[model samples]
Target: MTTNTRAWRWGQLLALTLGALSSLHCVELPTKSYSCSSAEDCQGLSGPGGVSYVCGSGGWCEAPAGSACPQASTPPTCSTSNWCWDNPLSEGRNLITVRGRSATDIWAVGERGIALHWDGTCWARILPGNSQQLRAAWPAAGQTWWFAGAGGSLLTWDGANWTSQALAEQVTFHDIEGASGTSAIAVGQAGALYTFNGQQWRPQSWDAGTSPAPDLLAVWPVSNTEAWAVGRNGTVVRGVDGGWSRVSNPTSVDLVAIAPGADAGTAYAVGRGVLATYANSTWTASSFATSTTPLNGVWTSAGVTRIVGPASNIFVLGSATPEPSGTSQVLNSIWGNDTSLWAVGGSGSIVRRAGGQWSEFPGGVARTINAIWGTDDRNLWAVGDQDLIMRRVDERWSPAAPPEPGAFRALWGSGDTLLAAENNPTATGGSNGKIHLFQNGQWTPSASFPSNGVNAFWGTGLAPVWAVGTGGLIRRRDEAGTWLTEGNPNTASAQFNAVWGVPNAEVWAVGAGGAIFRRDVSGSWVSQRPSGATELFGVWGTGSRDVWAVGLNGSAWRYDGTTWTQVSTGVTQTLRAIAGRSTDSVWAVGDNGTITYWNGSTWMPQVSGVSENLRAVWVTQTSVWVAGANGTVLRLPL
Candidate 1:
């Protein structure tokens, strides 16, 4: 018999047994027959093998013996109200460098040979037919462009078509600069530098005697005869009289980028926490005020200088303070015209600076999504690594202000009240847990909790919220907004990964080594370790008697009042989260974008187009939402 047929047979046997037990115990049982408008409504029911029930042609639930279960044959459709994958335009690809002649005409290149263009209104990806990472791009007069990257890949765009140019060896090209389309230079690993003479590229030899060759990172062409290249270990080279010569070094930090200043013979080079200026043929180094963030890109136009780096730091020359772009994304390249400035970085981060303020643009790129919660279909929040938080409003996702500078692991709330659990890092390379309350459109630190990392939260949005985390830690938030430490049943410490509760009094926490705890009527946590030693990551239930927990090694357990039984999931991948509309209908998501459904008697896998690790799952009566690594948000019909 087929899988569905076997499942149906088991269900029928179970239903018959339950029916008999209900009569003996004076309990109620659902009738075997059901009315339905669609197959989904008729699913999760009990029947005999090869006699599974489905929605008939007349729209009523009926058994069609020996028929196969319906299969998901096509890709799930994404809609504002239905299933969809919401991510940035880069599709989780990191954009390394961006260049544009104007705000309307822009091009960005990054890993996997991804190329994107902006035509004043929207961005579109252009296929380059390669997957190697593209490291640098330079736009030369009118539609002509140059892209260089890994494996010695060099591509030239001539307004209409892109053609690859061969090189002698595979080497990464870091940056490109040009005085004109014909007179340009590129720099890369191990002292690699090349010059383009309008027709072909030629390698330039630099003499360094017996010293090691420096990896050139950036080049700035003030003129064909006078250009500068900066690289590792403070190696600086000046191109003069048609040859390259070593220049005096100011600091040993690896210089990443160079830009010309307002006057001739004046320029600025920045790298790692050090900013250097070259004037009168001498370079001088100075520390950026109160900034330890490594600098990546520098630009100067009309004497207005801007430097961009990690943590969205933007330092303008002559300004007393550094302006924060309000994002924690690492900016790789910065460029713009007189009216606007753009920076691209890790996690599909793209921000624009105009009117003396920086604003982020929605790219739908995937970043790691660690936790997700929502009050309704539209008002949803997702948090992840690098202080990333996003909120959905009117079907559009936008970044929300981070509660604090740390990775958020869990969120729980209802209506306008919500709480977030964060792992705040310390200077000594460790982390501690903290809680933040969301109120009046902002997130603020809540009462102090334990120092251990908080991993999960569950409550009714009222007083007495429960949080579980490292070291078997359990804390409760009372109605008076004070956090009180609660003792767990386990004398030995265990890491708690997830928590779910029916109310303030009855709660369940699951974690490492198959550890499970439930709060007793006496307000004490008692160990309820089920079968197996697989680490449990998520827990949820329809009621106290129908609780379910999913975890490592594809382990899933269901609690039926008195006993916990193992449910066969048939896969070994770690299952992260579980949600359900009823005990008979449930869903679980996990690593490798795995999504499995439990229909009464059997568990089956569903195809998720993505391949990232799915970390969390949430379900309602009609919809299911999943969040995963690289900001992947997927919604589907329940």
Candidate 2:
């Protein structure tokens, strides 16, 4: 099959920035927990806005507590000023494979063509035009490297920039291997090959005539023709001078990563705890002492072969010795405190490891911790599921006492004043998702909260507070503690997940369906919307309109007062929170323990030790704090 090198067109940068773009709309109620049971449930002044949410089994919609707050339904007002704005250059990142020769030369790759490099002291991001999912990367020489991914995407890195290339066949590029910088090859879906010369990338044609085209995932090349590729359908292929031919593989469970030993025709491939070796054209399969988990990448370093998968499965080859495995949950994010590590996942499971021993934090309530952050190990916080909030203290876990018997989904704070939000589980419970503040030790509930659940909130020291929630809930509190509400520009129900403020008046918030709102000098909220299905989750700002917001499905937006624009962060991993002590030192955390840094403009990915669901982030001049489910707490160096 002839592979075509598609020309680069002006494509959308997959990176999401703070307040990049947004739209306005009234709130709509879903039919599930946060959903609506009837049309009247969404009845605002504009009829059923679809923002109606069923308030448990009772047929009443949860309206705000107030007089003349219609028994029929209350109006869904804008709630932008009460939330965190987006990060202008904060991008979503999932560090799938972390490999390094030295501390300064580490590379991690993941979905959305994300390729991030660490240079000992700091991290940098490289974006290839293709948003195709990237799987693995191997540095061939100085700065020259090769990466493989979906859509048959192949990329080569010269000392400076990344160039997109094509494979011999249009298959998902999975793995790459070579003896040195010059003799490297990449393999992917089907028997595909693309070799790298010193200058450009070109396909290496093999005349196998596309037999069943097994889903090739990894490749290790001994010589040019004496190369091997492994994939799904128990497929293994050997490359000869004329073409690539399939060899018999024992298992069909999709080999994800592979590595060649020091000798030619000697290699190892791994998938779901199944390890196979290829020698003299025959494949021999064996099981290791390692847990039968899905292994993603394998490598042979210093004569020892190690394999890593989603749950930190580290396996050895020569002795078949197994190391302790990481938690096998589909971890959404990760964080660490001075004494604890936390990993949150599906269900309300929050796993914590303190003193090198892993355990589950007992929140009693099974709720997902979507975001986490705090000042220190003893002052950590995590927010998620049904408005859940968990806190850590001296390595002990405690439920961050709920504001009400409601769900607290997002959180933010500065100093002793803390602001938390509630996404009303049922819209009919007269709990329009209130914003609660922990000042000193009292849980003070604010008036005029959200007409629905509050997704995220940000606060300065204590004097004034900003909170945003479901249904464009934009409410602000001035020095006098009076709640001011604003109307959204759009009629659709947009859920703002995050909010941030520079001062009492200069504030911003971001939300679902690409909705963004900004507060002017006069302390009034204005609506902004970007196009697409981008759902903004977390927001932070240096000033009034200069803010950033991140959200579901890896969407990020940036606000610059006059307009909102999107920036590329390479990875499409869902980002949950944004925090920066200074303009050049911003930190964002999210699902899969994604940690992306913003050097003022562009967002770069960083390694956050753990891969659990990180819920929130707080950064000071010299310290960074992240919190997550399972009592996960993390503190970073300045």
Q: 434-468, model 1: which lDDT tens digit per residue? A: 88875544456785444588888877654667888
RMSD of each predicted structure: 14.5, 21.2
TM-score of every model versus the real structure: 0.66, 0.42
lDDT of each: 0.72, 0.54
Shift of residue 48 alpha carbon in model 1, Å: 54
lDDT of 2 by residue, 1-638 (tens): 00111111100110121111111010111222212356554354111211223232323333332211122211111112111111100022344444444444555566555555544322244566557777667777777677777776567777567777664457776666665666666766555666665565666655444575666677777775567777875577777663666666677677766677656657888777588887776788876444566666666654555555544334556554454333333333232334433333322233344444433333212344556555433234566654345554212233433455455676666544556666564546634666665553456775535346666555554456666676666666677766666554652366667777775467667776666766667766677667763777778767655677777766666767766777766457888778776656677788876777788768877766555677777664445766654334556655
Best-matching candidate per lDDT: 1
Runs with alpha carbons beyond 4 Å of true place in candidate 2: 1-93, 99-103, 166-170, 205-212, 240-243, 262-265, 279-281, 288-292, 310-312, 318-321, 325-638
